[model samples]
Structure formats: C-alpha cells, structure tokens
Target: MLYFCPASVRVRAASGAALKPIQSINAHPSNCICIKFDPTGKYFATGSADALVSLWDVEELVCVRCFSRLDWPVRTLSFSHDGKMLASASEDHFIDIAEVETGEKLWEVQCDSPTFTVAWHPKRPLLAYACDDKEGKYDNNREAGTVKLFGLPNDS
Candidate 1:
C-alpha cells in the first residue's frame, strides 16, 4: 500500500522491505489527513482537510475523481473487498458510499455524531460504524456507536 504524509503529500510505496517513493501528486497543500488503497492495489484514495477525497489511477498516475462538498474534513475512506464501493466518512456525521467504476453515489446515511470509523462485515452484507455518543446535559461522554443494518430486501 502507499500513503501520503501530512506535511508532504508525496506518494510513497511501503512493502515488507523498505519505503520507496513511487510517485508524488500534489493532492492538497496542507492536511493530507487519510489515505486508502484498493484491495487489488490498482488505485488509491486520499482524504484531506480541504474537504476533498481524490481518487488516483496508480498505473496511469493521474487523478481520476474528486469528491468534495463535505460538511467537514474527511476523516476516513475505505474500499470494499470486491472493490465495488468506496466508503467515506467525515466530521459531518454522515457517510457516503460511491461506486468504484462510475463514481456514482450509492447512498448517504446520517447520524447524530460524527462517524469516526467504519468497516464492512467479513461475511455478511453489514457495516459497522463507530461514533461519539452524547448522554445528557451534564454528561457528554464519548463512546463507540452503531448504524442501521442494511441487507437485501426480502421479496414476498
């Protein structure tokens, strides 16, 4: 997998041996927060404080797509095992799932608290999400959270 550091958005490759730079693309000037790679290692995803997640074609070394208009900085992004969906979460308390090929938005879900993280279930059509939990006026304790379970609709 490859990653871009916060200070330097220069791309580098990391394997079992040593860190070798593959290439560098000026993604964002500052705050290159998070980076994710597709399972097959064909492409990569990058999220920045610029409120944008840019997709790159690793082989071609060109920018593929950019997703912006996020309510806040994009914190995380992940690709499904089959590489059909690209999931993104921001400090906006919402999640956007986009199609890998067409870059079309599959759906968006909202929660009260910001989605800190998300993972696709290993064996089922389910997603696990974690977020901050607020109790009451005197108590503002943060906690791990959950989202609604999504499954194929049943036909009668």
Candidate 2:
C-alpha cells in the first residue's frame, strides 16, 4: 500500500500481520494531495499542490516520469482501468488526460468552474469529475454541486 505523507510518499508491505515499511521517496516539494495506484498495481501516481504529477515504479521505488503543465495545484488523479492513461484535475477550470508511458498529453477539457476531483470508469474510457461553483456561476442560483462525465476519444 501507499501512504501520502506531507511532501513524501511511503510504500509498505501488506502481507504480514504488521505493515513493514519498504521505501519512501520525496514526491513533491509541497504537500501531496492525492495518490492513485494504477490498475495493474505496478505503478502509482502522486498529485501535489506544487502543480505537478509524478509516476513512480512500485518495485523500484523510483520516479519514472513527471508531468508539469498546470499552473494551479493538482486536486486529484485517476488511472484508466487498463492503466494506459492518467487523468488529472486541478484547481483551475480544466482537466488533463495524458499517456502514462510517455507523459504525452492526450487531451484536455475546459469546464465552467474549478474541478476538484476526477474518476475514470472501471471498464470504459469515460471520465467523471466534480466541479466547485461556490459563486453560483454555473448552476441556476443553486449551490455549485456539479458532476460531469466525458467520453475519451479512441484515437488518442
């Protein structure tokens, strides 16, 4: 399992009765806000307030790649069910999808409000995200509790 401590990430074994620390790495300069293990369990991703996303190899305990594109802090991350794609949401009004192996940006979508969370479908290339519209700019005078879904393109 993975532990998201402040400014670092720690890996531990869950086999024995007591958890044993395997390795720890400094993931981000600032606080790590979210973490997601890939569906294959061979890798994990960390999102930080420093506006970066890092992919780490589980066995080697080393960072494989780092993605830095957003100016705002990354609020959440989700791996596709097949572990081929990664989706990241930030405090800004956009969501970014990238190729896991090459760190190539696949696509990005702009929303009306700031997105705070993202989740990929378990079996399909569909993504769901929650937005914060506290100023009532998106909704019709109601509180800004909005969840939206989008289908990823096949060619990416």
Report per-prediction Cα RMSD to one decimal: 3.5, 2.7
lDDT of 1 by residue, 44-109 (tens): 888888888888888876778987747688888878776677888887867888887888887776
Residue-level lDDT of model 2, residues 50-119, one tens digit each, is 8999999988878899999888988899999999999998877789899999999988878787788899
State the weakest 10-residue window (summed lDDT) of model 1.
147-156
Candidate 1: segments with Cα more than 4 A from true spot:
14-16, 123-125, 135-156
**Candidate 2 total steric clashes:** 0
Best by lDDT: 2
Whole-model Cα lDDT of every candidate shown, in order:
0.72, 0.83
Quote the RMSD, in angstroms, for model 2: 2.7
Clashes of each: 0, 0
